[model samples]
Target chain A: MYDFSADIADCAQAVEAALDAYLVPDRLSGPGPAAIRIIDAMRHGSLKGGKRLRPLLVRQAAAVFGVAPGQALTAGLAVEAIHCYSLIHDDLPAMDDDDLRRGRPTVHKAFDEATAILAGDALLTHAFALLADPACHPDPSVRIGLVTELALGSGVGGMVGGQMRDIEGEAGGFSGNDIAIMQAMKTGALIRASVRMGALLGKADPEALAALTLYAEAAGRAFQLADDILDVVATPEAMGKATGKDAAMGKQTRVSQLGLDGARAELDATIAEAIAALTPFGPPAEALRATARFFATRQS
Target chain B: MYDFSADIADCAQAVEAALDAYLVPDRLSGPGPAAIRIIDAMRHGSLKGGKRLRPLLVRQAAAVFGVAPGQALTAGLAVEAIHCYSLIHDDLPAMDDDDLRRGRPTVHKAFDEATAILAGDALLTHAFALLADPACHPDPSVRIGLVTELALGSGVGGMVGGQMRDIEGEAGGFSGNDIAIMQAMKTGALIRASVRMGALLGKADPEALAALTLYAEAAGRAFQLADDILDVVATPEAMGKATGKDAAMGKQTRVSQLGLDGARAELDATIAEAIAALTPFGPPAEALRATARFFATRQS
Candidate 1:
């Protein structure tokens, strides 16, 4: 069986390395002082530490399909960039209103709210730029597919839709099923895209694509369920950002709907289902299967 | 001479028709009431009344390059979507804080701030989705090129960069050159992209592309100068939205830097240069040339 924990760690490192190279001072050349500040703000938000799990999925799926990891780097970077932009915007004064992110001051707190907003906007647009860069991938079909995947995952039909439901649910009321739908769109879309994109780049067979989709969906749910449990159990320092904010906002969550223990049970079921879905791929998907387990049980 | 005024008007109408079709209520189908609300909010913000000038350029440029006008429709719609997204975000409380746009309530005023933000985010992402859709264009290279153009025009190196400069300039202290740079990025990038994207779609020769770029740059400057003039000379009713917001905010507009008459003279010169840049393209570019004149003189 492939060591999924080690594979994910390697994938994360690869994503971080590419991001570091892309956001290096030299890459932002030819702009005035204000532009430079905006670029700096973008780098500050994007380059800071994160798990890089989404990009890792992209890379790993590529590996399973026998494509070079480098082949998926640009798409991986683009996905992470979108993820970073979402985090920045979500932490804005009018959104989640968080002061911290990944153990550092959130973009709005580090810079001003206007700068943070602009920075987020810049990063979001830049993700497409990276994907479209001729130097990254010569095949236009691949580029187009990657772009569509990322956009749909991040847009109203996906993450934004999920966030809208989240906030609206807070204002109204929601059942467990409603919470699941919200989580699926908000977090599951990107997770599914990560695997799908990686498979696309590797040109994985139809069977593998279907299995990966199922794996990602279940893993995504497990990740969110774990998050709900963490919010209740993890301390501020341990969590690296504000915890328990979901409950404070009177928002619906797996924990809120199912209770902490119930949420944990759900997480276990999700992880098992995620792994089971990958059984069609046999030992080659062991890494993915392990990653699902890890997601369900991560301390942070 | 090609009658650019009539041609551009037709192109604009064609693009609007396609956009209207694409945004029909059926396209937003999915689970969750909140998701539907978000989708509706995005469609409302993006599909509301506007001149459709940016999308028209994409169509016109495509025509200039000899591509079928039908081939440019999706690309045109994509650009307009991006334009609408920017407007929605720019009107948010933390940004321009405007209550009105195009004589109607701004997205935030019509919806909540959070919903408006998500709508903008969704539209921006959806623009790319449209560009990348295989059904829209069979050529992946064309899609990739379009994505690149749109991204650069909208991101830090273009519109977002200009916005940052505008915000920073308002905090006080900037030279005339700084103001020019800001305007070029904020308004000029997308305008230039409109022309360039059209040329790209038409498969214009490199020389034609260069000429179109120059034309777009000049026209963009003239367009901004005209806006400055209108802000000073037009009333709220004449301008559609607030007329004097730029001056009130101490923005470094052409009218603020030069007297109103001086700004008018500059606009005239820029428009003349824009028209001159199109001379090499012969009668084929008459529509673009006329559009330049329209941009210079438009009151709103």
Candidate 2:
């Protein structure tokens, strides 16, 4: 097995630096002075933390198809922006209402609720602008394609819609299928999009893209299962977030349905499926294969 | 003076229909069963609503360069989606805390606050997806251009940034120029983008686009001034929203700084400036001229 830990750390560092450059308050010195406050809030929410797992997937998947690193990094940043914005909103008082994210005060806790909301909104808006900019891709077609993919992954039928379902499920009555669908939309959609977008950047042929799609779907499921497992077994100190939250909130999850041993078995199988789907690209997919294994076994 | 009232109503109807078609819960029948709740919330917040002013501007502006009505309407609805999402988020308890909008319960009031937030997020995402879609235009460049324009107008330097300023102003230290810049961002950015999107659809040249920019800025100022004046004078019934909010919140506005008489005078001058900027395109700009006049004198 290839070691991908160093590769993950390097990608995370690159994403952090790029996010820093993008979230600066330079706009405050211009006509939009109010922008500095939200920019500050955005930086607080996005900078210096997180696994950058989605961006690393983008870089690794694009590498398999031989896409330029710069182009993949730009698209990855856009995906990260969406991911960061979703976390900010999810942690708001009206949503998950968590006080800590990445082991620090959440955006609303650090600033104010109003600033947090605006910061999330700004980051979401910024993602589209970043994708639409010529710097994202020299060809307008690619830029528009990226925008479409992102919006589909994040919009009504995807992440936000899944969030609505999750909130509704708090009152109980969610089945195993409901849990799967909700998890897919809430977390899996963006993860799938991260890989698909990388393949897009590479302009992979239809069969190659289809194989990547299969790989991403399995990866997305395995990632969510890991999160569910972490929610049950990890300590708050290790997770940087409260653990046992699913039980505390009485939220329905795969672990709740399948039992601990069964869920672990499923996760191992999911990881194998993810790695198997990447077999088409052989050595080019070695990093993707390592990343899939990493998803199921990582503590946080 | 040319009468655009009938044209305005007709365009508004077209936009309403388009919004209805786009926001249906058909996705509920497919893989995303959770999508219906947000879709319903989106419909509740958007359908049979306000004057559809932004979409109206897009249609009229696109009409100036002989663009197809269908293309212009598509672009206009994208702008309106941004407008709708901004309103939904702005009415959150953490923000303006408005319980009523357009004389009905706000999304947060009608649905839960969580649903309202997701609905707003969904709407914002939907707008970009609509623009990036192939149905938006035959030319990918045109679609990408609309995305760039909409993002710039709605992102941090524009509408959402202005919202932060307005929230900060509730503590009351805004100078007159501060009010102008903030209003330009909060309300004017989307307005400017509305017309510019229309021009983009028509492939307007640099000089003509410049003229439209001038017209839009003046029109934007005039529209906000009229709104400020209306807040002072209109009844709750007439406005379909609570009147006297600016004063009650102690928020600064043009009317707060300049006496009502002064604000009205400025509005008249702004309207005139907007009309004068249209001199470059004689009869082609008659509807835009009427829209400027309508913005200053509208009761609601």
Output the number of the lDDT-best candidate: 2
lDDT (tens digit, per residue) of candidate 2 on A181-299: 88888888888888988988888889998999899889999999999999998999998988999988777788988898999999999999999999889998999999999998898
Model 1, total clashes: 4
What are the lDDT scores of the predictions, listed in order? Answer: 0.81, 0.87
Task: Please write out the lDDT profile of model 1 over residues A170-239, one tens digit for every residue.
Answer: 7788865888888998888888888888888877778888888888889888888888899989998998
Looking at every candidate separately, what fraction of the true A–B Cα contacts under 8 Å does it contain? Answer: 0.56, 0.60
Which residue window of length 10 is worst by lDDT in model 1 chain A? A25-34
Model 1 lDDT per residue over B1-300, tens place = 566657766776787677777764355332222387777777678664778888777777777767677888888888888889889999988888999888888988888988888888878887888888875567888778888888888887788888888887778668758888888888888988888888877777889889899999998898888888888889999777998877787766778778888988888999999999988877677667778889887867
TM-score of chain A of each: 0.93, 0.96
Candidate 2 positional error at B16, Å: 0.8
Highest TM-score among the candidates is held by which one?
A: 2
Best-matching candidate per DockQ: 2
Predicted complex 1: CAPRI docking category:
medium
